[model samples]
Target: MDDGRENLDREQTIDRLEEFQKASVRAIEAHGFELKGERNGVAVFTDKETAKRSRDTFRFIAWDKVSEVADDLIRGATQHEEYTGVVNSSKRTAEYYVRVHRSLGMIQLRVLERQDWEANERTCGHDFTPNPPISSISALKPSGEKRTVGFHVNSRQEKTCIELSLASPTAEFLTNPWSFVSDHPLDGGPRDYSLKVIFDQSMDEAKVAESSLELASRTIFELDIRNGISLIFAPRERVRVSFDAPREVPRIRFPRVKVPREVAALFSFASETLDNPPYVFLSYYQVLEHFLPMAHRRDALKVLRRELRDPFFDENKDVTLIKLMNSIERTKQVSEEDQLKVLLRDFVRVDKITEFFKSADMKHFSNKGPISGVPEVVMHLKSDPLPTQAAKRIYALRNRIVHAKDDPKYDSIPVLLPRSTEANSLKPDVALARLLATEVLINSQD
Candidate 1:
């Protein structure tokens, strides 16, 4: 057989299968359980839980691969040992036995049942002799396949219990939550022998909350032996784990925002709806964020330069436009011979202007006609209207607060820094900036 025959996709399938098989083996070995045998490619562990878990994982693999292993298991299963239990009775004794069937040989319980005269007759009595109808019992099929068949023996008067399980076949029978014993040993088996009542976190509310409270609980399991004589209780304790790990928040697709048909759509609106509804209005912020890219792109710059009507200023002059014009005229009126030197000096004084000039060759601009100054450059910028000359200072303070840094008057602008400090609440400025940005963006797209 080709070991490397599996392709990448098929290899993943096989690798997963191999991992599951190895895990099964490790678990069984860890719990001191023995390995039964290999049926086809599937390795069978002696623990019933291991076999059951493997069976569950196997169903997840491809049907074709599953069938191949299943067929192999059937062919090689002749000598397979299956764990089984039986209830037997004779003229002298009534008994129950847990046994293992193997391909090589069979191993039966040395002593599983005891004589109980009280069980034979309803009243309390001590009989030394084994009861009537003693018979040896064998499984009709493999115990691995049977989900729930109780090998039960009970008392007439009080509760007596005994049971074995393979449900979580790999799970340890002794440590299993359902397999509890009382500390104070009583006569006979546990009153209730239930295998299905396993400690599943999903089922128990107390266990789920226990982790937070650091609480632990124990269950008592008992088995009663002959005529109220032998009683045993095993205690299984479980500490509650606080709440389970939080589930991941599901991703939500934001609803599309459609612009009015009369108004041209310039940008997309995207918002996330969280599990808890936010009380504040976020539409204004969303609009601003959506509008910036559409308005300021280089390709759309030509269109914006035409439609950039001054929203804040009026008929004769926009505040920004007027400033630009005044600055331009002031430079032009200066004597041609001294204009370059004075302009260069002003450029050096302005931080932004100095950087703009230094970014390119100065000699080229000296030879060229119109040398742009800081104010001139500001005119060309296609950004939202300036919130404030002090906006940057307020933003810096906000940043300090957000990052857990202690700064006095964090929300309040200090009176000392007159130019940097302002009383304008960012809420309204932010809203207007968004609307203005949208206006610029839609017009630019035209």
Candidate 2:
């Protein structure tokens, strides 16, 4: 539901940033606000004035999530209100604020929340959901206390199957779950989102569901991050769903590649909890880092092979043996950055990297420089290839994400936790990390 639900999100400020491009015309207009104009990616709204002020007719300033609003619009609109919005994947639903008229000469926004605005009596009570003229609202009204959901099977065979059931009398009680936005701002916040997952598939009998538990578990974590709801699988727990799920097979796509469980888990883990930007970036980087030890060993193997190939090499002589030992030690003693460089050089495809950055979201990375306080990834053919530059950028970012306080290596990055506008902007970077990690994992195969 698009209705505003306000719980004390870790740092609510950053999570609540509204994107101007994503907000719909209907929702924006419903508040009696019109898209008066736009400049520099900001859509300025001029609605009926909140007060009978002489000069300032438009007085609401909103922060756009992806792009910064025009400074002129901000200065013109900041006479009173401040709005931030978030629209869901469907784009049909939204979670944003509506201005509640103030009597005490201060602005108030109506939203469902645990606490009042500065404990003000004039503000609407907690449990309040934004009343957006109702005409623009589309809500899923479940009939009874529990809603029945048809879970479809994702089989290679004809999916036109029969209804799935379980023998237990308590079958109805054991439904899969979804977290409504209102659920976030409340436990008692009037919304019944409890759902049941069933199909011709039975967990009790066949112990089967379309997607594997490991994959489903990862999806559940992503839901928690995106929707701000915590969902853990119940012991002896089962299946889940997506609304008209897309045709996405070969989750890795194309040729079958062997990736270790550890690497796959790390890669999946990065996707699941990405809303927490700093940690997510770190996690993604760790996917590449996992191969660092193996990378070191590969270098050592090369050194040993070179010595063994030399016909004049002698193990009996102290000088020759000591030289080999010295060579191996030197090979294994490269910096973390150097090891990462080795993995990228050995595993990832150069042209494919150029292709990866060609993505719409990722293109800006080539121009905008690195996320957080890190060096830019300068792509060159020979001296500074994409992989080497990538290593430099990733290592610098890793350092920044690690240290809690001020440090010379990463002082440019600040400590404003999940206040994640910048972190949220890191989807492209995350994708890059996933690409590199998957490449290394797949390419490392025998």
Candidate 3:
């Protein structure tokens, strides 16, 4: 009787377990999800929305296990799109969009409109159709967060072609990872891109990108040198050149090569140290053939003084004397009526130009009257104006950069100056060094 009862109890337990499994399946199905791949006790669900939501929404996920992911995989796994569209407009444009993952920081991309489509067409072949307003500024109210989306386009297709092919800065993080922007509409068919939508609740601290006018105040003023030059030479064929080809034919090459380096160290020692010690020190035994040479400090200073007085000057104006003066200026934080002294102090302080000169001796004598803690600085020229104005401007700019303050009148050029094959043949990295040198040379003389 005991054995029979035990068998009955075991059968009842098995039945209950089966019932519970069925109920679990039923519950998942009711939620529009299916339990597949359960034969090995493993289940996989194919919910497009759920997977997409996981990508778009930022939450506390175990990122330590999956720290980094390539943009392509992210796009494929989550088909998020950034877009900005104008209603009733046929012309297409790019939109700025952000992709936020709980595991990864925000990935920002620009979503562009579908070009070559009919005005009445809803889609561009098979490409993603970008709609208006890339970001959702108003979406933040209820959950205390907003989700904005934006799109980017290869507007400068050919010019940016090689750079894109080379995977330039932040370009590797963009759509069509391996392919250039010109190769878009992949295979001449619809191309897919990803953008993220964030649910801000999970963020402990977050600052959203503002699209308002106040945001404009933070921007630096720069004339589009590339665009200007292009306009000036419109319909003119300067020359076509190949990257691998030698300089056999006259050709117009792209300028303003950006090679990343430590900028903070460059201006710091220029206050009192010679470029020799600083360059060697800053270079840290790295390749600096393109930057300042490790020549005698005295010789470098002589060349600098002559150039500041006359950027094109060519007189043996005591290179040794100049070097000695530079060392003294750097060693002490003293300021004098001499423009060169003011320039060194202002350029090296790593503060606002006005703040740097606030307590300096120039505050008492110069026509500008001690900076006054105003929004801007105006230096009146009494005499000797070859490149002095230019020199003063360079000093002020260095100060602005050091302090993280934006100068409304300053300009950011791809290349600080036009490339001249005759004057200075600079490699890509060398060009960056030259630009830094220009800043140092000008400030040293001032």
Highest lDDT scorer: 2
lDDT of 1 by residue, 136-235 (tens): 2123233422222233332333322222322221112222222112211111222222222211223233332222111111111122222221212121
Per-model root-mean-square deviation over C-alphas = 29.3, 20.7, 24.3
Candidate 2 at residue 3, lDDT? Answer: 23
CA lDDT, candidate 1, residue 375: 16
Query: Each prediction's TM-score against the native?
Result: 0.16, 0.46, 0.22
lDDT score, residue 439, model 3? 44
Q: Candidate 3 lDDT, tens digit per residue, 118-183?
A: 242222232333332223322323554432232222212221100001111112122222212222
For all candidates, what are the clash counts? Answer: 45, 5, 23
At residue 94, give the lDDT of candidate 1. Answer: 13
For candidate 2, lDDT tens digit of each residue in 1-446? 53222322323333334554434433444444454443222233444444664432321222332122232122221111111222121111111211222351111111111112223312322222222211111233333222222111222232212211111111111111113322221232222121112222233322223222333444346434653334332222111211123366536557577777776787677656644555667776888888888887887798899987888789788888888889888986788888989889888888878776654354445546435566665545477888887777777667656657856754556553332344445556656776787688778886
Question: How high a TM-score does candidate 3 get?
Answer: 0.22
Lowest lDDT sum, 10 consecutive residues, model 1, at: 78-87
lDDT of each: 0.28, 0.45, 0.27
Which is the leading candidate under TM-score? 2
Cα lDDT, model 1, residue 227: 27
